[model samples]
Target chain A: MGKRVGLEVTVAVAEAVALCRIDMAGVYPITPQSHIAEHLSNLVADGKLDAEFVTVESEHSAMSAVIGAAAAGARVYTATSSQGLMLMHELLPIASAMRLPITMAIANRAVSGPLNILNDHSDIMPQRDAGWIAVFAENGQEAVDLSIAAFKIAEHKDVMLPVSVNIDGFQLTHMVEPVIMPSQEEVDAFLPPFVPHATLHPSRPVTMGAFSMSDYFTEIMKAKDEAIKNSKKVILEVWDDWGRQFGRNYKPVETYLAEDADILMLTMGSMGETAKIAIDELRGKGVKAGLIKLRLWRPFPFAELAAVLKNAAQLIVTDRAVSFGGPGGPVFSEIKSALFAQANRPAIYNYIIGLGGRDVAVSDFVGMFETVRADKAKAKADTYEFWGVRE
Target chain B: MNIVENFDLFAPRLINKKELFSCGHRACSGCAEVLSVRLMCKALGDNTVVASATGCMEIVSSMFPTTAWRIPWIHVAFENAAAVASGVEAGLKALRKKGKIDDRYIKVVGMAGDGGTMDIGIQALSGAMERGHDMIYVCFDNEAYMNTGIQRSSGTPMGASTTTAPAGKASSGQKTWKKNMPEIMVAHEIPYVATVCPSYPLDFIRKFEKARSIEGPSYIHCFSVCPTGWRSPSETAVSMGRLAVETGVFPLFEVENGHYRMSADMPKKLKPLRSYFKPQGRFRHLTDAEIDAIQERVTAEFNKLTQKAKFL
Candidate 1:
């Protein structure tokens, strides 16, 4: 066990990467994610972390450099938010396709059009199909824990794919929170030295990221799909191992009093903590409201989510970003699709809330439950409704 | 023995062995770009890893289930070869420091086309060079985007006809001059920077060897003639490259430690620019006035380079 210290979440993440003893970091600056890059650069410059900090020009190059480093068998990391993540969009799939096992921290923020820089899932939503093992952290503690675990999961022999830890912008990244900083020995014991499956070596040379034709492109994509899907097994095992070692058990879909509740509210990222308070309030007033927080967004906990939502008669899903004209929100569409085939599924009602960093109060959650319970059929099962839209 | 005698005895023996970039690849007949890569790869030898950008060289050398590269190679994306090579160099440094691998140094090379290096990839290239990574960056200049059906590129010289900058009633093909890449790299103040062509294989090999021997970043701009993109007869690729140097359209030179020197002998009487431009169909649309303008610019650029090379 290491000492608990009050550290900003971004700094906490940088310290966590330092604990892992990464060989190099390729970083470019973006708002809300700049502190992580700044701290990591300081760590390398101050000789705290013996790593090569390549201050790359853009997010595209940052990803490219890390892919090169990871291909050369170095444990590497980088972080970005919003537009930076979008800029790295082209190389994200390439990183996973090459099986580089690079761990990226996405300070989740809304994508630009109005150019708003606030907490939302819009950044990571478009990258869902980029073939990375995506995980969400509800708070600073989870951010630290999952940031460390991301390397373990990504570098695992069975799950040799890039992993992204999505932490909410400003809400979680800027907050100062007390976190248990794992010691060097603890982290070393947990994460073994990264042994690359296939590295670029002159002695025993290999070809990586070969250009594929139509004949083999489908099979190659199928293999990547299977690799990410099969990673769920290792994810669960690692979570269990982490729980046993650190005494903080994590799950794919975590529940707060949802075992017997008739109504459930689903949330992801930092908003889950706020929804937990709403659930408590609803429970106190005999409304039987509960909360289900999704921790793993990719290789999504489909079975766990179905099992949890099976008992509830109605479920209110809180989405931080809107899908705009397609469905309602990205998470709501995913949940609807996940429960569409089930025979005994909950009537899921999605409320697109907290977009562009819009504040959602505890009373809003109670109101959402009241509205859903009173007129479940009026909102319709196919589409979603906005919670606090100005009329 | 004199240098010419040593080269005569050794250069062919060095390049004629089993090729690092093997023969069965799908490069077009008389493709000078692939020839440049083949010569570069042969010079780099076995202790090298290549990070290639998305271009004709990458696509032709590596089409899945088959690879022409016998040594380690990677293609990350179009505009990131230099950045990726920087990572590879750094990664090898870390791994070697940890004693996880053997002590011998491995060379990392970045290969990109003019489009990948000059236009979309310029930022990454500049960043990598400024950082001074121990890597070699080779910008195989074919003047236009040949891999994407001959689009105009920044490397495209003025008055050259490309698909994107076609010679029409109102336009005289590409409007701008070629972006000076070697000077750009020289401005980064790295240890080694050179311009070579596949027409002179001995010079290309020697430059690559010198580049790999250097301690910091080295940039090599190889003038690779694209027979298809240039709309020239396939057989004239090597001849066109030779004419380019003799005509002062492309100069063979090297800059080491801020000192510049011409690698190839200056033509006794500089060949008319028409001797170089007339052979290629790309410049066929140029009128006498445009040709005079091009000749004036080429001679002026050559004189400026000669003045700088006097430092040698």
Candidate 2:
């Protein structure tokens, strides 16, 4: 058993990385994500972590450096947020296409234009098509666990793809919670030393990141799509193994009072925990309000989502980021597409909440459930509303 | 160092027989850039990893299913070669330390074109050098964005007409002087920085070998003659590089630990700038007054460099 200590989520994540024994970390500091980078660098400086802490100039270089390091057969890590994640957007797909097993932690925050640095899903929404395996954490414990599991999932021979473990910015990252810091022995058992599939070495020369013209671009993209789609099996296997060892079983889509419910509320990231409380409050009022928390964002748990949402008559889907001039919210649009062909699809309503870290309290979620119940007769599924917008 | 001493300009037998960069690359017929890359590969030998940028070299050498590189090479993107090389060096160091890989010294080399090095890639290059990674970054300066088109880049010399900075009734070619990338690298206080051209193969090879021998970061700016982009005859590629040197437009020199040393046997009196410019059609539109102004600027820059060397 590992020791349970009250530590900041970012510090716990850093400790988790230390336990994984990564070979190198190329990092740059950005708001809400700076603590993770600082702690990692401090670990290297104090000799607690035997790794190269490359303080790259920008998030672009951080991503580039880790791609290079991972290509050179090193287990590499990095972290960023908001504008930094935007900066790294260019290389994210390149890393995935090269099939380098690089792990990164994204402190989910709002991107600029209003220049806000707070909790939101705006940072990671743009990276949906970057071909990386993305997971969301609801609390400190999941943050640490998912971060450590990220390396295993990434370096798995069957799934040599990069992963991004997204933790809600200041909401989850800055909060201190009692987390079980897994021992090095446990992590070592879970993740063996990385055996790279192909490396940049003189003895075995291979060209990586070659330019693909129209001759082979479509086939290469199809291969990448298939690779990510097939990685779901390994993700489940790793999660099952982690559950067997750590006593905390995790699923792609977790539920609360969801079985046989007529109304369901859906959320991702730290808001899931708050929505759970709302579910409890709604159940007390004799409204069969269930909750669905999406944990896996990439290689999205489509089957699991459909299964959980089978019996629900209505669903209140909450989104932290909006898709301008297109559909309601990014997640809302994807869920609508995922369930478009189903025979008994639930009436879905999207409520874009928590723009730039406006607190989405328990009462707010209960209000959404009540509103959905009241408007059940005339529920317009195509439109979305901003929850707390003053205008 | 002794390997450089044995290098004879005329004797082909003295050069290493191993060709790390194989022939049959898709580089244009007389591409001096590819030749420079080939010589650099020979100098570095087999124990090297190359992180290339997205440019003519990467596209030509590494088309899918057909690679001309015998040494391990990677092309990540256009502007991150230096950063990638830093990661490669650090990765190798960590692997060797952890006994994950054998404890043998492997050199990390970064290659980029002028647009990759001086324009979009300058920040990454500066960061890598400032961090003092044990790597070599060679910027192949053809003075324009040759891979995309003959677009103007920061390395484009004055009075040189590129597609973007075309000489017209209103404009006089490139408005600004060529960016002094070698001097900018020297400002990083890196251990070594050099300028080489394939026209002087022995000098180029010697400098690459010396760069490999250094323990910290080294930057080499090679003068690559682009015949198609420059609108010059394909056969004049080698002579174009020679003319660049003879006219002091691109001098062969080295800066080691802040000490400058011009290459031995440099012309005491530089040839006229017009002799160097006459062959290329890019500069054909330049008026005599424009050529004279460019000449004056080139002479002043050369004098400044020589004066620095004298003090050293």
Candidate 3:
């Protein structure tokens, strides 16, 4: 650790990327994610980070450029959010299909119909199948740590897939928090120079993104699926190494006072801290309420999540994005699907909460817990309710 | 003997250099696009990487487990070839500066069809050029979306029959004239921009060679004849490309730092537009009035180019 300084989460993200010594960055400006681009350009301009900063006209080009840079054996970084991520949707699978380890930071925001540029997971939920290793950050420190760790995990020899760190828009990205930024020397030691598995070079020629017909398309997709599934092992090891080096431990499923709790609340992103506070208040009232936050979104962490929630009697899963006409929120649906066949599983209730930056206070969490505890029959397994929605 | 010797003087040199692009790929029998690509690759030599767009060239050249390309090549998507090439150049630059790779100059080239370059891909191409990336962008102008069965594209010339813009009693085939992509590249104020036709193989090679030496963005718009899309005989593909330039339909020129110069000498007596359009089945429906209209437009465009070249 170098020093604990108050820094905006986006700046910390840029600093983390700078420490990693990226060779190229192609970024487009989008709301709630512009600071990352701005700070990165500044870094490149100031001669602090020796990287080519290409101001791409749009998110599509940004992703395309990053993919190109990665294919050329460059350590590349980019950042975007919400509509920007949606704009990059077409190239997302291509990046993974080509197996370019290009890391991107997504300041997660609500997708627009009414155009809400605020915190939500709606943006990344659609990209869950885009073949990228998606991770979530709870706050500024995790944003910094994961921003750095994403490069390591993505460039790992076993993995070589794109990694996206989702920092919740506005709530986390705009907020200033004390973060222990690792030194450049420490980062250099942690992240070895990126050795590309295969690169575009005249000396050693290779064809990437080749067309696949029906005869071999299924096999190619199956191979990609296996690659992502197997990436979990590398993610875990990288997180473990980070914990040992930095003294701040991280896990796929993090529990807060859930040792013997009868009721458990599940959350993702910055809402976890708020849920923890609610858990503390419920504990003061002699209620056995605990919190569980999912750090790894993609490759779902099924076994670890199942082990953690096995003992709970009830689990309140909060989602910031709606599935709209589906049974519940995206995360809720995944959790239900994961626990569907289990012999002894908790009664899981999903509350779509804090959507589009609606303030989710401690009182809202308490009310949600009270409602879940009061309802004995547990409603239905696949049903969800909108918490704190007016009328 | 004198006529044979003169013809031999203009023939493309069969150098001992290996073909970076090889046979056994799946292009159409008389594809001028592939011919142009083959010649372009030959000019670029071994020290080059290609970022190709999704089109006929990409689909035909890079089937999984087989590739026509002997050099490093990638097909990212339809509209991002220029953007991708920008990334490749930047990545190579970083590697070379860091002493991670030998400091030999390697060329980055972006290849896309007319639809990819003029339609959905315009933004990426413009951005890459504006950023002054050390790369070459080659747009094979077949003038329609031939990969998707000849849909009308912005590059489609006026009065041309296509699936999307077919000729009828009430309407001419394509309402708009072919978009001038070389002028658009020149507007970007890049270091070099040129127009070439595969029929002139030596001229094509020379333009690409000059483009490769340029330090900044260079654009090459090649007027490729799509015999299948244009409903012409397969054997007429090369003749069609030659007819396009000789009839003043598509001028072969280069713009170096905004200085426009014609690559080939202008025809002393321009061929009539009818001779160029008569053989193409897509233009068979054209009436004499329509032919006259096309002739007027071609002559006017050619004159405008001649004036620009003279001023430069």
User: Quick one: best lDDT, which candidate?
Assistant: 2
Which prediction has the highest DockQ against the true structure?
3
- In candidate 2 chain B, what residue range of length 10 has the lowest lDDT sum? B1-10
- For model 2, how does the per-residue alpha-carbon lDDT over A1-391 read when each residue is reduced to its tens digit? 8999999999999999999999999999998999999999889999999999999999999999999999999999999999999999999999999999999999999999799999999999999999999999999999999898899999999999999999999999999999999899999898888999889988798899887788999999999999999999999999998999998878999999999789998899999999998889888989999999999999998999999999998988899998898778998988889999998899999999998999999999999988888876745665599997999
Task: Write the residue-wise lDDT of candidate 3 on A111-157 in tens digits.
Answer: 99889998889999999999999999999999999989999999999
DockQ of each: 0.85, 0.85, 0.88
Q: Looking at candidate 1, what is the lDDT of residue B125?
A: 96
Q: What is the full ranking by TM-score, best candidate first? A: 2, 3, 1
TM-score of each: 0.97, 0.98, 0.98
lDDT of 3 by residue, B43-100 (tens): 8899999999999999999998999999999999999999999999999999899887
**Local accuracy by lDDT, each model:** 0.91, 0.93, 0.91
Q: Would candidate 1 be rated incorrect, acceptable, medium or high by CAPRI criteria?
A: high
Candidate 1 residue pairs that clash: none
Model 1, B233-298: lDDT tens digits are 999888899899989998999999999998854565579999898878999989999999999999
In candidate 2, the residue pairs with backbone N, CA or C atoms under 3 Å apart (3 or more residues apart, or in different chains) clash, namely: none
Q: In model 3, what are the clashing residue pairs, if there are any? A: none
**How accurate locally is residue B82 in candidate 2, as Cα lDDT from 0 to 100?**
94
Per-candidate fnat, comma-separated:
0.85, 0.80, 0.85
